[model samples]
Target: MTDSTAERRHELSSFLRARRERTSPSDVGLPGTPRRRTPGLRREELANLAGISTTWYTFLEQGRDVRPSLQVLTAIADALRLGEPERAHLIMIAADETHPGEDSEYLAPEVADVPKMVNPNPAYVTGSSYDLLAWNDAAVELFPGAIDAAKPNLARWIFTNPAARDALPDWPVVAQGLLARLRTNAGKHPGSPRFQRLERELRTSSPEAEAWWPRYDIATSQAGAKRVRSRSGQEQLMTYASFHVSDQPEQILTIYRPA
Candidate 1:
């Protein structure tokens, strides 16, 4: 098998195991058992719930080369009670098709100009790996030196930069959410050298990153409110929304406004 294929399978296995281990029997309406070797539903129980053979499910969790139909995957997803982001990630990593924009590094000139158009709103655009591709003046003011770095990555900044911690009042919560989103992106682009390097860096440089990396949590960028400490030492609430760039789905444009 190709390296990317192997990496994807390994990730799929890990994801399934993590999700299964977190789901309790009571959560699935199964009677709680006091005597169990491990938490969550067993392989056989999950297979039965999804209406599949236990051996097949075992093979999947073992990272064997097995192709499951979408219907079967959907059944497993439903049985596991996966949220939207986690369910989408499961299906994406299981498919054999190559991801769009996986190999492309080109950013269109017009697309690069979008952040500037939303001036004064602290707008910025990031690639699939959360690398800063473009930003407005407001973004520069909001996140000093982040966009000016040789290779600025928002994930790296959130986890490793002291300035980020100082700026974000709820640093731990924000960091965890960003890491979860990064995990979701990693599912889409397995065996990517960029992601591998970033993960290694974060794991080495940040204790929280290392602690949370194995949890297999997944998230998507969505509208939310954030609390930030201004330069004047006053806490300010900001509302933010993220959008995928048209025809360039891998690029996300995010804008923030005062809440």
Candidate 2:
């Protein structure tokens, strides 16, 4: 009923609508509706599938005084075909019933489900915000002393850690790309604690990082063609590919192929 609450509800409504539209009828085992007025499920059909009343669903979507229950939120989330983050957003909104008039931040962690990277090619998959979630065997072997899953961070390794200076044959190329990409993440997630921690650690540990952290930018490591020097002193250049499992949007799968 408050302006901020109304605004957040409106935003949530728009998000739900957009996500619903993005899903096709076949995706949810629904028959295609040639005569359907909208591109996806109608509000009534969705409410029916969610087992909630049409009026309640409509009130929720309309940014009214509708306090959604966990069950109801789950139902709506499923009906809307929301991803985990989206589902989390719905849960947060529904669970905060006591504070009806207050707005909420619903951004789910971008790194919540990043895939476990493994294998012979040196590669890593980070969040859309560039938090290093996982890396492969080759990446570990090449970088040696870099990935401490206990402390796995690409930016920290490239900048703060000294091994990178020796591990990288072309430090500037690797370093620049990394810094630039991290700069980009910073811009998108300025208030992110994980990002702040990484930035703080880098600043305290590396001089180059301190200099670059302030120039926030928005870049992510996706598909990049690059090479590395193998332990045998041979240059092993390779192209890397990143995969985002459709079923697991939060997890990013990065695979490396030796070229």
Best model per lDDT: 1
lDDT of all predictions: 0.88, 0.61
Candidate 1 lowest-lDDT run of ten: 97-106
* Deviating ranges (above 4 Å) for candidate 2: 1-118, 128-131, 245-251
TM-score of each: 0.95, 0.49
Q: How big is the positional error of residue 91 in model 1, measured in Å on the Cα after superposition? A: 0.9
**Clash totals for all candidate models:** 0, 5
In candidate 2, position 219 carries an lDDT of 40
Tens-digit per-residue lDDT, 143-210, candidate 1: 76577678888998888888898889999999999899888888888888888888999999999999
Tens digits of lDDT, candidate 2, 191-250: 445555676887888777776555332244468776666656677677778776465443
